[model samples]
Target chain A: MSRQASRLDAKKVNSEFLTLTYGALVTQMLRDFENAEDVNKQLERIGYNMGMRLIEDFLARTSAPRCLEMRETADRIQQAFRIYLNIQPTISNWSPASDEFSLVFDSNPLTEFVELPPDLTNLRYSAILSGCIRGALEMVQLEVQCWFVQDQLKGDNVTELRVKFVRRLEEVIPAGED
Target chain B: MSTYYFVIVGQNDNPIYEKEFSTVNKELRKEDHRHLTQFIAHAALDLVDEHKWKTANMQLKSIDRFNQWFVSAFITASQIRFIIVHDNKNDEGIKNFFNEMYDTYIKNSMNAFYRINTPIKSPMFEKKSEIFGRKYLLS
Candidate 1:
């Protein structure tokens, strides 16, 4: 596929449509759930569902090759994010085993002009992104645990997410039965 | 060339859609194959639940075998399950078929009126799946 066709056209969607719709959705969830923690979990669950399906579209559009290493997976995620969302996040802090890493976003479009109430300090405003990553990775047979370690909305300079590779899922075959 | 049965099960374990087809290379009487295929697909569900948590990959190839019947499965993150039963054993072809079905499922889900885990009644989805089966498996 041509690179131009793979990239999501920003012209097709109005910027205000994304900003307003996402902002309103979050606000509605916060109201319906009536608890910051519940709202955060709900957002993550919604993102998880969306991510499950979105990965198929991502793969079809990018035609990306399967990553042979965790580092490559991180790079693929970065490329996917850039092409789909038009934002780039720096990936760093790889563990010695190369099973864990962090993604630091300089600017998060989801939280533009958003402020968390003092009572909702415990809520992870960008938990949905983490959920998306987790769901997408799981689909590719990589079981991972992803959570936000820092958020710009919470006075952090950058939004940081820590992803820990749990284990590779192995296909089970009946032993001595086939 | 053999008969094939395809089933889409909801997260709640309810069947949402099903179809049966035979390979073009060999003709099998549809009436003769109908009940056996349904039984095979239904019997494979228990094995699917047994093996689902053991792996994270969507394509669960050849989860169960009963006599000559073989079953493979593809699971979505929302917990939807795509199960296939066939007399011929070809894991690679089944995986590719499931991937196409997954794409169709995603498109169907995008409809504003469609709800997750509900029986898929869209004629568009049905037609696409039929075409995929004819192209990839029947021929």
Candidate 2:
């Protein structure tokens, strides 16, 4: 049983046209739930579980080097989005301290046909993206807070994901070393 | 976008290998959904048997349909069956994927260290399956 579960990593090799199905799932979940916040929470939880599993597949496929700096990590993440979803998010809006940055997506596959209804103003249609980033980063020993500050589905010009470096897990790096 | 549930059935109608090709772990985890897919796969087994001798070709395009899902079947010379339950249409892609998998199965089933008609444990097999699956089916 466990071996079968482990073999599931094979399925994560592709992510093309996946968001449409994911969108269907999200829409289904929206109908099931009365509150948009709860829907967001559900989507986040789903993305978290997906991230925890997908990181292994990502690591195996990409063989990306261990990132010593978060800046490099952001670049690698951009590469990942490009590879998996065929979207390259521009890394911008860096904080002065360099502990935070925003990933600006000019085109998001998830929101291609998604339109937020006026009734569900609080729904983050793609909260799963944030949860996925958080969970994938956690596997690499990074404790980062990630969320969507702007979404195209929510009438934003573009989709922007904000990631904040909280603290590194199981590490004791001295300050000023970046 | 489509979801494919692929399974390889060995002798005695036993499942030797299985995979669900979709965005992994992203689907809403309702317990009944998977059970329904499984049941559809099982229900199509008798249909596969009924159609096995109808065609001379190894590939049996699609044998059954359960609502939105379609069951496609391919059989080996030794009667090992590969079944895929999917939500959309892509006959060419599924045929290409099965051909690729059949090649790997030939190599794996011939291995001295590997047992016949049992679970395939080779990393190379899984790697090629994923690569070809993405190439032919999910592209």
Candidate 3:
């Protein structure tokens, strides 16, 4: 199945349509919302919804076992993005407690065609990416807090997302009451 | 000929996919008997839970039995379960069936339209389930 999945993936996931569609969606959201904060929230909401299901597809394709620790999860997230979205982000800036780290990417496909207006500096164009990460982690019984700290679109050298380990959720086994 | 009933369970004991592969004639197969198959599958969830954490292995073979019927379970890493209720014991074949069903379940879940924990209503899923049931159970 992995062989078939990899073969199919090779023919799939061209970024042109995805990039343009995201661009259009953000533009429409920007127009619909009164402030940059609302627009960023909308983007993150969309990404969170997708992320809930994305983990299933990711697990199905990769059959990845559950990560033993937060550090392992960071590496798995990077690997997953590389395989699915074709982005290679480096993990750095670990907290002394090892509970937080940052994902640094120089070229984000979602931003390749995006240029933010100066007034919209507070708008996080890639908030959806962090939302997706949080949503996917929740499904695996891991609760995390993810947010954008820097954006190249805002003239930063690289895009950076700070991910903090909040707490691990315990799997709630059904009581079979139903 | 053994009759087999299978169910895929998601979180909160929600049954996502269910099927019966029966060699018995429809007219001869009583409605209560058919319902009994499902009830047995439901009753085994507790046993499945008890046995699942005992081993890291996915397949908990022959976890429950009722009268003559036996239940086999395969728990995914995400805690979704594939369960089988059968009158005859064929451990190897049941394992093969669970593995195939796991692949099919994953493919269905990967569909952008399909959610991880919901009833699998796709015709393709039904068709593949039938094919796998025939290949692994009746043979």
Candidate 4:
């Protein structure tokens, strides 16, 4: 049991380490560039690139076999987000009136028990989460536009995020005339 | 001896790092483009390839480039590699530099925003690198 406990501790350490480090990096980058807009752009760019690469690592580490289709891929993303980040997002609604689907996180772990620094209250750290979703969707060649429709922290009555599937991204098919 | 270039290569031999510097322990002009520095970095990389085959892990001075440059390598338990190449002017100072660099690198890597194995040439990197170099190396 000691071994199992040790492993759990290690995993927790690693997760916290990643979170702290990423936060510091973003904070420092924003300061260096001296631009909040640029910082957000970097955050998204970084998230997309990271998501593309992390999908491979996540697959390798989990060794859960594979996802057979885009739907499965999306499911896998939801599962990973739940287990790794402790945020449970539910998929719902997606209609012409909304023009986008929603991933409702009843509780946001990154922001849980946490208050944003005074200057950063307006800055959204979870933007990276949106980027990751977009990149992961793109990897399976599913074209989508994702954004935070609502953030509980920002005085929205409902804490929710909506992702819109704009159009199907290019699919890399096998080489064939067919 | 003359100079050293050091880089971090993963299991796939992709360059996670590339830094060139004179062993002379004097700062090059800030205007000096990365090319001149990266030129000698070629040699340091050659040394890394040779060393990886022999050692499972490296310490503070496992690999030294002449009297001018010293290469320090670290491979995370996950097999992510980190390489630090700086002048041997001060080992303690160099160690501290690597620590800060590692902190920044790890954070950047963990960021959902960044891709793995990407060059650390972002504006953030430049800003942090300058701050770190000034604090540890210049002071």
TM-scores for the candidates:
0.52, 0.49, 0.53, 0.45
Superposed model 2: Cα runs more than 4 Å off: A1-17, A171-178, B1-139
Displacement of residue A103 (Cα, Å) in model 2 is 0.3
Q: Candidate 2 vs candidate 3: which has greater lDDT?
A: 3
Give the top-scoring candidate (lDDT): 3
**Model 4 CA deviation exceeding 4 Å by range:** A1-10, A14-19, A60-74, A96-99, A113-122, A172-178, B1-139
User: What residue runs in model 3 are displaced by over 4 Å at the alpha carbon?
Assistant: A1-3, A173-178, B1-139
Which pairs, if any, clash in model 2?
none
Where is model 1 chain A poorest over a 10-residue stretch in terms of lDDT? A1-10
Q: What are the lDDT scores of the predictions, listed in order?
A: 0.81, 0.82, 0.85, 0.61
TM-score-sorted candidate list, best first: 3, 1, 2, 4
| Reference-based lDDT, residue A47, model 2 | 82
Relative to the real complex, the DockQ score for model 2 comes to 0.01
Error of 2 at A151 (Å): 1.2
DockQ-best of 3 and 4: 4
What residue pairs are clashing in model 4?
A: A46-B113, A46-B114, A47-B112, A47-B113, A143-A169, B1-B66, B5-B41, B23-B68
Q: Looking at model 3 chain B, report the run of 10 residues with the lowest lDDT sum.
A: B107-116
Which lDDT tens digits does candidate 2 get at residues B40-96? Answer: 888998998899889899999989998999999999999999999998999999999
Interface DockQ of each model: 0.01, 0.01, 0.01, 0.03
TM-score of A-chain in each prediction?
Answer: 0.89, 0.84, 0.91, 0.71
What are the clashing pairs of model 3? none
